[model samples]
Every structure is written in C-alpha cells, then in structure tokens.
Target: MHMSVANVVIIFSIFSSAEPYSGQPHIVFFVVDDLGWNDVGYHNSYIKTPTIDMLAKSGVRLNNYYVASHCVPSRNMLISGRHVIDIGLQHGEIGYYPRGLPLDEFTIADKLKEIGYATHLIGKWHCGCYSNHSLPHNRGFDTFFGYLGSSDDHYTHIIMSNGLADLRLNDECVGYKYFGDYSTIMYANEAKNIIAQHDENKPLFLMLAFSAVHKPIQVPDVYMQYYKSTIHDNERRTYAGMASCVDEAIANITEALENKGMLKNSVIVLTTDNGGGSVGNNWPLRGRKNSHWEGGVRGVAFVYSDLLPMDVRGTENSELMHITDWFPTLVKLGGGNPCERKNLYGVDQWEMIRGMEPSARGEVLIALDTTRKASEEYRTGPFKYDKFDITTFAAIKMGKWKLLTGDSTYRNFWDMPDPEYGVIDDEDFDDTRMVRLYDLVDDPSERTDVSEERQDIVHEMLAKLDGYEKAAVPPQMQTKPRLDNHVLECMGPWID
Candidate 1:
C-alpha cells in the first residue's frame, strides 16, 4: 500500500515527533573523489550511474550541501567534524608532505566505536597518514584496507607522481599483489568481504572512500564500452567509465549489505569529497575543483535509509547542510553523545535529516586560506573590488549571500565538451573582481559580483571571516622531505 506524501507527512506529525538516540543503524558512507555536479545520471541523464541514481531516487537529496574545495580539508572536516581553520589546514591540502589530520581530534569512527559499532575504512584515507598516529586504524576504525595517500593509480595501485606503491591491508603494504585488479572492483570486493564476515550483533560503520572518477582516468575496457558512443572527448569518455565502475561497485556493495541483513537497519550516504576537476563537468555553475565557487564546494550528496520518514523520502532538501554535520548526526544516531568531545564545530542534524525540523545551521565557513597576503585592508566605504586587497583568501555563506575574497585558484566555469549539455562562453567571464559577492539564492552560478551593491552584507561576512581568522591555528604544512630509499619503498607514513 502506498501513502501519499502529504498524507504521510500529516500522519507522521500526528503520530510521532523527533526521538532521542534509540538504536544503532549500520552506517555505510561512500566518499567519491572529485565527482562533478553533472556526472551522476540523476543530475545529467547523459551519464550512466544506475546504482547511484536508484539510491538517490529513494534517498533524500541534499541540494544545498557544502564541503571544502580540496580533498584533505574536506576529509579532515568529515573525520574531525571541525573546520579547516580550527584544524590548521587553512593553507592547502596535505600532499607528499609529512602531515595529516591532527592526532588529538576524535573521529566519527571513534565515536561510533564507543557505541560498540564495528568500524572499517575501505579506500582513500586522505585525512592524513604521515605517521602511525594519523592512520585510519589509529583514528578509530577497527580495520583499514586502503591507501594512505592523496591519489593512486587505479590498476597498478601506485602513487604515479612518485612511483610508489600505496595499496595496504591494515599496516602491511600489499600493492605488489593487486597489480592488475582495478581499485573500483578491489574496493568493492573488500567491502563485501567485510560485510560478509561481520558479526551481526554489532552495528557496522563502513567508510568506502572510492578513488574513482579522479585523475589518470583509468578503468576497465568493458566499462568504457558503456559511454563510447555518447561521450566524444577521450578523457571524459574514460571518466564516464570510471564513474560506471563506481556505480557497479555501489550496486554490489548494497547487495552485500542486503545479503548480510544490514540494509533494513542501514543508513547509506553517498557524497563526493570535493567538486570535479578539469575532465569533469559542473555545468552552469561557476568554477571547478579548488575554487571558492558553488561548483567546487557544493557537494553532490544524498542520504538513503529505511528509517527516514516516508514523507521525506525522494524529496530534495534545500536547507543548508555542511559535511561537518555528519559527525554529530551519525554519532547521535548510533546512540552516542557527540558532546563528549570539546570544541566540535558540527551540530546534530538528525531531526532535520528526518524532516522533523528545519536545518540546524544557516551559515557555513566554506574555506580559509591565510597564506596569500593582501596589499591593503578591507574598506568600509564605497569600495572598488580591485582597490581593497583581501589578506586572507576565504569564502563564507550566510543565509542568501555568499562572499569570496582574494584569489580563488581556479575561477572559470566548466561545462562538458559536448554541445547539448552546455557550451562555455568565452565572453561570459570577465574575471576582474577578486572581492566577489553573490546572492546564491538567486545566482547559484556566481555570475554577478554584488559586492558594490550590497555593502552591508559584505561588511557582515568580512567581520565573520575576521572572527574566524582570530581563532584559527597556524597551518601544519611541513617542508617536503627529500625522497630517500624509504620513500621509494611504499606510500605509508615515512616518519613513523
């Protein structure tokens, strides 16, 4: 029997209200790397993402969700539930350098573990792996089967930039054994194995962070056949194949969950770490990955669970939600208190997610890069965007207004190379203003700079940035040590 959405909402309201922490739900979080807005089949019909599309169809689509512009910062927020500035990662992402998410910060997995959930991390531990203290197992997970670096080759399982193996099972380097197996399949098999062998008595917290649809654009030839005729560009064609592999992996993982009798008591969250890269598409939205634009930080995210009220299922949530909120949200759902840790920036949005209340937050501090020095201070009077030099490159979203100051690394809008999706207009972007402001409520594409017209909002956002700047700790970036014999051996932390 099917109930109408209106009827379900009324019935739910009459019968039940938001409840306190009740029971643990198996949490399966999928963090896809560099997934674009238009990459999913639900967003863009041209792409074939049947699994994700199907899940999204039954899930609560987060239309106004936000994350950091880069991978490490985003992953840091996800794990620690703290902002980049608070965590001293405001400058940039951790690369080959020896640093990671702070050791003191309690992770989401750690909180879940406190409530007796068996936590496992299956791919891309980009939060930090500069030392044993920063590894996934140390952070909170009971088991970790993934690489400990930023990116790696899909099949070879090697960090191609330095030609070092990265595949690992717990602490042991195992990239040598899985030379030809694709990461999408490899990770899927690992997830299924974890699900199959798990003890049903304990709840599961499986974080499957896929390295798919990222760089190198590598996938099996069979997957590429799905997009051969539709996508013309070689890179995009290959990217589509990689996306398809991820979709199939999700399908298999979900089936495994069902087989394990976990699906009925599961909460599956699918989201991208950041925005898409050069090869990806975020059409009609300004800028690509690493930019302070909507395309860069506005994540493609959704939450699917049988626990969600029927009224909210398949509905789009336009309320403001940040990646950090997941910490408290999941922790509370697992019957654990998030307030046990101090200085947490995340707020529990469990009620909001279940459609029982409005969003817990109204504003989000997108990113703060304090490395760049401005020529002059922010002005109070009628200021020209060019005249006022922004010392800190930052972006903030409050209510309807969104503000960006200083240089956004990549500020150009990107569209799919195909003609039908959309075409990039050379004359569309003038690229003059560094201090840019847009009413995201109206101008999500970030085409117009409203800094001149809206001085009040500008001052408000600037004050907010100033307050955050005063509280931010110094960045933890260290000098890239000379690559020695030890570095050539594997990709785990060399400093341990």
Candidate 2:
C-alpha cells in the first residue's frame, strides 16, 4: 500500500473534490505521559478511556506507531524531527550535559508560527532545563502554561529540584501548587479557555502535553472510586484513576473545540509521549519502559479529523510511524513547507494520514537509554536490532525471525521499585545468556529460540547493526541521571 513519488499528483484531485476544511485546519495534539499499550479502553483494559475510544472510532487508528522509550528523547523527536542519536541529544536529560533542546533546532511550534498560526504549549515541557533558551516560550510558542522540567508533584507542583514550584504562565512562574484543585482538570480548563478565546482569524497549533499517570501515582478520590474493585494493586488502581482524569480532560477539550465549532475543521492527534511506566501494562508486547522492547517503544497513536476522507476514518493503519514524523507532518498541515525550512530526518506523513500511502518510513534509529546502562536500538525494514549493554546483549527482529544473544538478571526500572513480572520464560536460567532466535510472526511473545538452525540470518542482521553502531553518536552524559536541583535557582522568583 506504500505510495511512490509518482502518485503525488493524484492527491490534489481526491481532496480537492471533497469538502476539505474551509481554511487551514486547526490542530490539537493531546499527548499524555507514560501511558501503556493496555492502558486505554481501546485495548480492552479496565482503564476507562471513553473519550480516547470515541476519538479513535472517528479517526484513522495507527496500530504500529513507535517512539523513544523514555521521556526527553521522545519529546525531542516529536518536536525536532530528528532522533537523539542523529542530533546527539541522548539520555540523562534530567541533569545531563547539553540539557534541553538545542537552540538551533526549530520546534514544530516555531514552524507553525512562521506561517501566521497561533501556537501554544499547555503542559509538561521536559525537552529542556531551566535558564535554557529551549523553554517553550523562547522556542516559538505564543503562550505557555505548564511545568518546565521532568515529572513534578501533581498537586503541589513542587519538584525535588530545590523544592521550588514548577508551574508557569509564559516565562513567569505561576502558582505551582493548588491544594485541592486537581492538576488534570485545571489543565483541561486552561485548554478550554485557550480554545474559547482563540482568534478564528488564524489557525491554531496547540500541544496539550499532560503530566498525568507518570509517577507518585496520584489521583483524585472520586476518580479512584471507579477502579477500586477492578485493580487490586494500590499503585495500579491509583494509576488507572490518573489515566481516567486524563481521559476526562480530553473529553473536555474536545467538547470545548466542538462548542467553538472547531471540531469538523480541526485535526486532533492523541497519544502517549512514550510507552507506559510501571503501573502500565504493555500486555501482549514484551518488555517495559526504559528498555527497547515492543512494549517499551511501541506506543498508542491516532489521528481524528472530519477533514479526512470518510472512508479512511474509523479504520486502522499498520504502517510504521516514528514520533519524529509529527514535526514535518504538522508543518505541512499548518500550511508550511518543511523541506524548504531546514534539513530534517522525518518525512512529511500528511499523505499517509489520508490513507494515500502505507508508510513513508522504512527504518528508524530508535534510542539509546544512557542512564546507568545502555539500551540502544536501530530498525531497518522489518528487522530491529536492539542492543542493551547491561541487559541481554542484543535482540534482532527480521520479519518472522528474531535473534537474541544474551539475558539480564537486573530488570530494575526507574519508576517501579520491585521486580514484579517474575522470571519470564525461565529467562533467569543459565541458557538465556547464550545465543538464541525466534520466529516472531508465529511467536510474538518470543517463547521459542531457533538460533542453532538460523545461524546465517543471525550473522547478517548483526552485521547490519554493527554498521549503525559505528555511525551513531554516543550520549554526552558522562554520569548517571540525577535530580535537577538548581532549576528554581536558575528560574527567578516571579510567581504569577
């Protein structure tokens, strides 16, 4: 179903004949933090996501979307149209060297702003650190109302970073703490206000990046009441409640858009920033967040728009899509030519969203989670070679064939305190440390290994991975990721 360069001319005729948006289409990116594969209602989980499910039903659902396994890198790719490896913006963004997004790189907001679109970012801005020019306001957002660092206490809005508040309105720090007001609802109201007060003269490009369901697993008592019986684990139950709050927020935003008569003429993108953290279930997929597994890197994504052809809506797309594609795709949607702007690694996926092509991408340099250990990966065609230096040495996937070289006893993650999944596939056994291979098409769970029989395929894929490793730029962080303590010191005491 992949389209060739020759079919470009046919696109105009199809959309031109239909009733497209009267003017440039408004876009609202509803992005969440650490949402799991099975977290949403669409995946048949306990989590009630009626809003997300309705959006998916009315849009083109992308089933095989992928993103970086961590936070900062994923945000960087979505904004910059380049992977961390290519840009040298690798892990340890909490307080690593070369913190925040690079100044030279143009964010999606920056491109949208050039075309006279009103740009706003209303939530977590984790791509940069304090005092850096990479903050949302400095990087082309017309207005910013959110936190400026990694995960902060939702209720108090206080971060471990010097105990200062993280909330802000534009460059000025606002009331980070709201003793009783739920952060999710407060954010939802802010987005609703943005839509209500929007100037219809110009198209809107809004990124509502919510910080729900990340850590501290905090949720309002009312929201938690719904999942008390369904989820027994206290942390998981609270996490589900947090996700529900996010769901309600999305519903509110969409209703606001509809109320303002922007729904039919708008394009709304819904997804998580990355794979789920601990209280999440990547069920049916292997591995968790912080590691390069199907569960960790593959994320939930969807595009809902009445502007899209009627036939394409309510359908599923299995084509590959990386988080970086959003930068160029949104640029094109906002009436800007990304090709004419700067050199970019992402291709314009505007055509793909319209169901004109299968996928514009064939490969991706996934990520290198460089905290205390290394979780590196690169995928070409159907083959994915994941290299985790501290864990199992390497994992390769070539269509039906998957090759594993070793195993790791240390499966500890940042969010989860205990090893809860138990010894997977007897992987704690001595045999897992040796070479192995599996037919992924038949056994997606990777329960079988046929390395002894497929020695040739294993060698070929390993050679390909070696080439990628040589060209990749190692992460700049010389030390482990530490808490950012000087954020408030760097950001002045200007509470709004």
Candidate 3:
C-alpha cells in the first residue's frame, strides 16, 4: 500500500514525538553582525555593555565558538543545521536562490512550529531576495518584519512584512529611510512590542537578527558622544556606540521577558554571525572576517537560562562548537528530537550547557571559496592547509617545520607536478602544487616557513589534506545559480 504525503507527515510527527521531550521551548536567538570576540565588556572590551555583561554573568560563555567567515552563510547554517557549502551557500554578498532552503528540508523554525510554537523573525532577513522562497514568512516564520536586503538606511528602512512591503515613514513610500536616532534602539523597541503582544499560552520562537556594529558606521549622536569619551580610535568609537545600542536593546528585551514571566522558561542566546572586521580585534587569533583563520571564524557568544545554578551561571565553556550546533542544541532544549536519520554536522550542545555532557567532540569542515570564485584555506585541528596559488598547497601546524615543492620565490623547484585536487575547483587558480609546511605553535603569527626540516610530517599532512579535500563537496556540483525568472517566480517581485 502506498502512503500519502499527509500519511508520511503523520508518521514523521509520530516518530518525532516518540522522544521524551517533544515539546518546543521558547527560543530567542539574537544574532549580531560584525561584533568582535573581544568587543563585549565580558570579553575584555573597554566599551560599556552592561546588558550583555549581565547576560554573560547569568549564563554560559562559549570560549571556542565558531561561525562562518561571513554573515549570510553563517545565518544559513544556523537555520538549516548544515554546512554553508552543503546547501550551496558559500558567500556573503550573493543573495539567496529559490533552492536556498528546500521546502522538503526541515528548518529549526519548521520543527518548532510542528511542536506548537509561534514563530517570528524580526530584522535582516538575508536568506534570499527572490519572491516567495526568499522571505522568512515562506520559510516558517508566522510573521516577518524586516528588510529583504543586508544594509540600508536606518530611519527610512526598506521593511517587508509577511511578504509585503507595507512599512513607510512619513507620507512618501521609499525603500530607504533615515531610522531617526539609532537603528538598534528602534529594533529594540519593535522587539519589545512584539514580545509584549505575544500570546502567553503558546511558546514563541523569535529570531532577533541585528545589523549593528557593521559597516557604513552610522550611530546616534548620543551614543557617539558617549563612546568617543571611552574609545580612542574613530572606527572603534563608532563600533562601541553601535554595540551599546544593541546592549540597550537586549536590556529592553529581557525586561519584557521578565514582565511577561517567560524569562524562566525561555532560552535566550546572543552571538555574532562571525568574527569582526579590520575595525575590531579578535585577539589571540590572527586574520579578519573573510579569511579562514581563527580570527575570521571565532565569535562572541552568551547563553542565558534560569535553570542553571547561580554559581555556575557565569561559567565559561572552551569546548569547540560552531554555528551549525545551535539548531540541534535548540531542538534538544525545546524537548524536540535531534535528527537521527541523517549524518548531520552539528552536535547537540544542550547537554554540554547543562553539565550533562563532558565536551563537544566532532570534526568540523570549513570550505573556503567553495565555488572557486576566490582563494581559500582549510583547517583541521591545529593544522592549516591553503592554496593561494594554482599549484602550491602549504600545510602548517604547531611547530615551525615547513614544506614546499617549488622554489622560495617562484621557480625554486618548479618541476614538481600539481597537487591532487582537494574539495575545491581545479579550474580556479590556486598555488598549492608546491608544498610549504610551517610550525605555527611557537610562531603562532605564521611569520616564517620551515618546510625544509619537516619533509616527513609535510608528506603525511599532504596525504591527510588530500583525503579531506576528497571528502569535501566540489565547486561544480555545488548549488546552481538560479535564473532571474525562476527567482522572481519563487520569491515574487523584488518588492511585492
């Protein structure tokens, strides 16, 4: 006997409910843009961020948390519970396609909805800019009030609600607007209003994605003046002001939760989409936002829950975790089933947070320029293998031992054959044919190359890197770029 689609859904629901905790938790995910690892006061920042500091003190701090090197991909991973490359999302600037989040593939929001929760996404819906497929309303959000694109004027914001461009400032209907005073403050007020109006009977899943501490560095005069006194650098001063706005917003949100008596039953998470830009510092790690270095991927994260003890509330966890983990972790916390059928990349970190699990153990694969549109690097454990040139793959580890196939400058030993293809595009230009290895443990800054003394380890790591690349998804087979017509049909007109 053949089963109908509804039958299949019923069976899936039954299977999902077989677990002990099948109820959904009230989730508030506060994703910040370009916020540095050390930008918050809890992370040693000079700027005053009392709200975030309070949250950190009341919750757990993830010391080794990681995210995509950029925004869109990181957000995709958080929602989809997959590596950015797995879903054909590898870049930040490119908008989402129709096939971005397949309807068949369940999302965090979808799962929560299934278990009886009200979903709302407020701010920066950058998943896609197409028609029905691009907006949060189509994805699983019961309500969506935010901009379809990335950055825009704060006051005259180009906002979309439930797939319609209905928001306007004054009498003119403009896409962009000056969001009088500070945008963060405005977003905070909006969030507070939404929370206050939420039905208390059902659980709420609110995604508070903020476009603060990002570029175009605009801030309200009040915050700017306050930051100028504490921060010396011009750029940092603006960053501090933007961060302060986010803090105040958080304060408003927490207060709303407290007043509604949902604070004890809710799980509130505050984290950055990725590492900071050149304007911010990711200290102890090298490199910035776009690179595969630690500085580019590491981010600031704090989780608050009333269930934990006060003494352990302000604790720190150094276990390595990534953005993908949030999906499974949230699901588990909400008493939902962790995916058991497929081999998902994320780990259920809820146990770790509750002191039930010892540490997070899983190898994370990061794809750099998976489309071969640009250069990229790969890191596993303490090892870093990169291909900056078409024929040179350099491997670096704890010590200073380095390896290279070609000469120091260009033609040192140019007779070597190109290295075998890893998980990247062969057509894309890469200088990995010449193998260069470095001991980076002592020389963490990677100032010198010592490949000459480490031929044995170099050969081993080359083989390992080759193995990893072979296991990774190739560029051509990645997500195909959708046609404009198809995009329009899927998402609707740019502004409907």
Top candidate (lDDT) = 1
Error of 1 at 380 (Å): 10
Across 157-211, the per-residue lDDT of candidate 1 in tens digits comes to 9888778899888889899899998998999999999999998668999999999
lDDT by residue (340-383, candidate 2, tens digit) is 64577788887888898767875555553333322333122123
- Evaluate residue 207 in candidate 3 and report its C-alpha lDDT on the 0 to 100 scale: 88
| Number of colliding residue pairs in model 3 | 39
Minimum summed lDDT over a 10-residue window in model 2 is located at: 410-419
Greater-TM-score candidate between 1 and 3 = 1
TM-score of model number 3: 0.74
Q: lDDT per residue, candidate 3, 111-201, as tens digits?
A: 6776778888877766664445545776777877665555655554532322223222212233334335356776677778878998877
Candidate order by lDDT, decreasing, is 1, 2, 3
Off by over 4 Å in 2: 1-19, 96-98, 176-180, 368-440, 450-452, 477-496
Once fitted onto the true fold, the runs of candidate 1 whose alpha carbons sit more than 4 angstroms away are 1-22, 374-389, 416-432, 480-487
Q: CA lDDT of each candidate?
A: 0.81, 0.70, 0.60
